[model samples]
Target: MKRTFTEGLGRKELAEIKACTQCRECLRYCPVQEVTGRVEISPSEKIRIYRDFIERTESLRALITGRDIPEQLLKDFTRAVFECTTCGVCGEVCPAGIDTQRLWPLLRREMVKRGLGPVGGQAEMPEVIRNTGNPYNQPPSERYRPWFPDETEIAEKAEVAYYVGCTGAYQAQPMVRGDVLILKAIGIEFTMLKEEEEVCCGFPLFITGQHELLEGLVKRLVDAYKNKGVKELVCSCPCCVNMMAKDWPFYYGKELPFKIVHVTQYALKAIKTGKLRIDHGLEERLIYHDPCYLSRGVGVIKEPRDVLRSIPGVELIEFDRWGRLSRCCGAGGAARKVFHDNAVAIARLSIDEACHRGADRLVLSCPACYEKVNDAMKDYPKKVRIVDIMELLSEIIYGQNA
Candidate 1:
């Protein structure tokens, strides 16, 4: 079965769609096409389809003004759109300076308005997020208990708040716990929004075109944070950071009261301030995987590596694609939930790249990347130990406490 989007092709989008230069640089960096070798998933091809559609629509404007839109064009366009991970890597490489990352979500909004959106496993996301306040639909009580024990000294109100997003709370509990332990050992003043009070940042919803749900979720979340008196928010998830720093103000129709900072930023400061001293040393060779949302979305290319280098005896290496050219872990735009095999395949490319570089350990900042890359490396011949930066940092600071 195929779906088509026939609504909400705004004039601005139509005009910008004409600017594609056809240089195909975006296709060179697309994780989907790189892993799957499907030209249908090429970012260049996607733009070409949209361009051709606009050209045909303009030529037949008068005749089809009150008639049906082109169904075949819409079908082809929708398929190409969803095939993307929306990692923003394409936009970084686009010669025309087109923002394909933004374009994809806008197109998804059109797809949803016309009932062609959120195909496959993503169809049930709204209900899950609505009922559970999380896309995973896990019980709220089960969320924080795994990582945030009752004995942990989390204040009800504090100047700094640590937000462990859905992925950190549910999928990577150990990573979150390790981060908290390190924070505790370092004696930093911080608070946590109990899992009950925290909800999905709606990055998944926003990227998948569930605007109504996203708007409501944002209001509730921002309102909670505003009432909580948190002056600064530190996070361990890139998707949550991107949603808060990039989308929240626009979605809330006002500026946020607190500033958003990823945990790597916090970690870097802790290292410099002598709060998180590397009391112990671990000698290892590791490569850092820059989460797409962090590097391109938030423009944080060096903080994680800086944190790594600050530690003793840690050799921070890079793969062929690093910094601005860092590859995706195949987990953006909620693509993993919808395109599991393809997502793992994209992740395998990076895993192989890291292993081939002779990196015995792979350090990552995003929980989504951690989960996806770990899964992808299960059957891989190379035994690269995948660990989150926070977890590895804990080993050097808190030792057994992590």
Candidate 2:
């Protein structure tokens, strides 16, 4: 059964759609617009297109004549929404305070149910996760054992549990490895799920708007942690953390048994408690790239910078658009899989800015940004060292290259 244009949207979303003034202020900050220069795909244009569809489908004329929206118009809207990184900058800049990040996915969810979306390679994610327990379709056995630090001990059950999100476990191993190394260095007793016991957190599916599997996946993961007696859950991936904190309960139908905190937030707490020490220092200038999900999705804007600043003899550089207004690294919204060229192009914008700012290292916290920005670093005329905050800290403290 196909839903009407206005279905699935709540009062807030409806008012947001109705509130779009088409002021176009968000266009200047949109990374997609900055790179593609396609006004048709701009945020304001997307809202306009959706709003028009709602009016057309609901109008009295449509009921009398059995009118239908044009196929090309729907196709254009689908492409426009999926092409976005869902970075939420549009929402941050919206004069009417429309939450475009949240709105875009709801819009995409409607389209997905109508057999009209999850554009390009994104449509394959749900099936891939189902078959292999991850969006990357990699074997589950290879998730953590390959990179587990031998000397570190994982408690059989602990109050704190670390979630090695799919991206960090499979793609950016060094980042999660550093996470464990830091945990052990702080002497924090933490537990982890067995390699095969952990599954996708459903962020890929959620962001792409293929949400049928989200509830099952969320329940399974949440129950696993609950059985472990986990009081707090720590994750390095912002996408996973945001999903757990914001949407997991909606699916679980109650408050979660545990709290979810980012690795940076956890590490900062350790530092403040004197459980973790920044014993080593790097004498170099560094710029931190705030991952969109971490900075905006969860309002974790201060912890990462505070962690970076704690190290001795390090100068931190800020991107002109930092914190809530940070630019997307282009890998978000599942866009990188389909818009490979655009993903790299948008990532280069950040790298270019980092290099031009004369930073020796460009530090990142999210695995998605870590992977995509590193890919963008290749074949570029200039280079800035890309390192995850965990990796950088592990190297600084342990005196070994992470």
Candidate 3:
């Protein structure tokens, strides 16, 4: 059932778009709107434009008046449609209670019908997921690069298997290293899927509206895990954890044999039970940026902070906005690709808050947030360090050498 553009904007979507009275209240609260200051660029304004385009009579009249929409406008619309991080910040402050996040996806499905979807880096992501079982198009054998050869062998026979996502495997190498190190320090027996056996968790695909392809990927992943007789599925990527733990069952119509846990949660459990030990001290002030997926998406707020608090000599400072209400670093939903400037603006907003708090470092749990925030800080006046929770924990538990 390929969705058509008109089919995507059914009554529900149309009503949401139509319900917007152009109050401009959402405009004042929008992070992007604040930076850009373009009323037409605000989330509500964009939805109104989309609604007008859907209206046949208005679209034709605009075209006849030489105000016909241009290809770039369409492209811009397509980009803006999915550019939102879906952080719910807009809805949180929306006086009209309009759900822009939900509206954006429905709008995006129509854009996809027009061959305008999955913009920028996400353009080829669905195809990669369809073929490689992951978006990186890397062989499953690559998944084991994070583990020592000896540990790999041990993992094969272990009761729990740690799924190191693509970012953990390739981009954030330290995260993978830290996860293995912490697991080993805790003496937790876990196996790793050999490179050829690993698959992408299909979050990008699921979010991008390639919902039909999800079942096959989910089936393949669940089958592989079940065959290992693994009791737990631990991962460092919160997106992967959300996909495997929550989304997979929705697509596959069955609960996976293994339970899913983010590595942070596991680390917190180990620390509390005295299974893992930390001897390091942090004398500097630290502020935790709740990754949208980790805190708001899954509500795993306490564990990461708890782990931070367990460290000696570290002061955890709260921003005026924190926890589920925390602002986004602006890299999610392929926003960085489509609207790079807007994404950076959002990232800078978060960074400005961190600087205002007078913190020496910005601690994050999500790899996406870590990457975006680090990039955003490059132009800032202050020299604040951005660190992933795993990297910080590893430094504390394993020392500088580890």
Candidates in order, TM-scores: namely 0.93, 0.98, 0.84
Shift in Å, residue 162, candidate 3: 1.5
lDDT (tens digit, per residue) of candidate 1 on 47-88: 777666544444565355633457876776776687678998
Can you write out model 2's per-residue Cα lDDT over 135-218, one digit (the tens) per residue? 999999999988988878889999999999999999999999999999888898999998888999988898888999999999
lDDT agreement with native, every candidate: 0.81, 0.92, 0.74
In candidate 3, what are the lDDT values of residues 177-287, reduced to their tens digit? 777778888888888766666777777776665565778778877888888898888888877787787688877678777788888999999999999888778887999
User: Relative to the unseen true structure, what is the C-alpha lDDT of residue 183 in candidate 1, on a scale of 0 to 100?
Assistant: 71
Give lDDT for model 1: 0.81
Which candidate ranks first by lDDT, i.e. highest? 2
RMSD for each model, in Å, please?
2.8, 1.2, 4.0
